[model samples]
Target: MADVPALVLDFGGPVLLTPFEMAVREPEGVVRDLFLEQGPLATRQRPDPLWADLQEGRLSEREYWARKAQAWHEAGGSAPDVPVMFESLYSPPGPRMIRPQARALLADALAAGRRTAILTNDMRAFHTQDWIDGTEIIHTVDVMVDGSVEGVLKPDPELYRRLAQRLGVDFADMVFVDDQPHNIVGAEALGIPSVWLDVTDPDASFDRARTLMGLDEVVRDG
Candidate 1:
């Protein structure tokens, strides 16, 4: 870990603490049903559509919301309500806390002078303001490379490469962590070592290169 020059973090599962499944559970199904009942044209230009564009850094939040509002009007859906929806999507059920050990590990890394950044494939509709309010974890990072702002999605080597470039570090010199296996594999293919974080376990034990509990062990081991 000390040898590594930079660390790349994933947002959804790591830094931006939220129970995404629950947050979108109700709205997602309803939205999908609406889309199914309607045509692609009616739904394709909506806020969620900005998801892809945001992932590719092709659309900004402001632009996405405006278009979405218009799309909703055209589709006869309720007028696009950005503030309400944004708050609903990004708001957490309760206070989201960082894993104490994980936080300690990150603080140590930063104290040791290592560079760190956030690289998440987040939704376009969700704003960073929600993240700022919801969690205290993000304050530890040096950079925030959100896919929604970058216009690139993970599992895409280009995104990893771009992040590395932005951090001014070589891919091999970085260690990335994410909860998704595919994302881990994708980073590995690019020569970036990665750890798969599983935050649900009570014991918090992780297999080699795969973390089920927290990143303390990985940081210590690396």
Candidate 2:
């Protein structure tokens, strides 16, 4: 095995551009505008008391998603469930959903014989089977541990431990990256080095991961 630190990445915001980002950049129609443009990204730009419930942990991620899915269905979206809703919102061109920087980082890391894994809370929950199978990053990674499949979510210490155990690496030798603060803390609590990805400034976060993993130059936007 390569002696370099193993890299663990969260799937949503860290690996794929979040649905919110996609929605804002690629507005499909009324459904996109209703559930996404008026939801998370909107909450990010302006304070919404309900969204605050999510930040403060009063609302579970599932609860928030359920609310959005329900609203979308009620607003005439064809997909009634989260998974279908997600596929509809995200659309085809699966590879394009991945951040370019993330793609570069994973390519270089794997090329260097580093072990990389995706630890996601919602890979299975929010995606169709075909989508997961077709996603290049999903196939490229050394391993993927999803909470929806494993019946646990991030910020839960057990999830972190399970990932380390599966990789057969100690927490000290792994670098974890996640966009959620709570998930980062969970990994760090176990002595894992982590980078909290700032979605607004993603390049900076990827730079920090590169430094921590002893990788070469950062991926610059061209």
Find the candidate with the highest lDDT and give its number.
2
For model 1, residues 101-201, the per-residue Cα lDDT tens digits are 34554665676577878887754445546555556567568877767668877878988988887788888777787866678888989888788776554
Which pairs of residues collide in model 2? Answer: none
**True-structure Cα RMSD, model 1:** 8.3
State in Å the error of residue 59, model 2.
0.9
How much is 142 displaced in model 1, in angstroms?
Answer: 1.4
| Model 2 root mean square deviation, Cα atoms | 2.9
lDDT of 2 by residue, 52-89 (tens): 68777798878888877887788887766888788886
Best-fitting candidate, scored by TM-score: 2
RMSD of each: 8.3, 2.9
For model 2, the stretches where C-alpha displacement exceeds 4 angstroms are 35-40, 43-46, 217-222
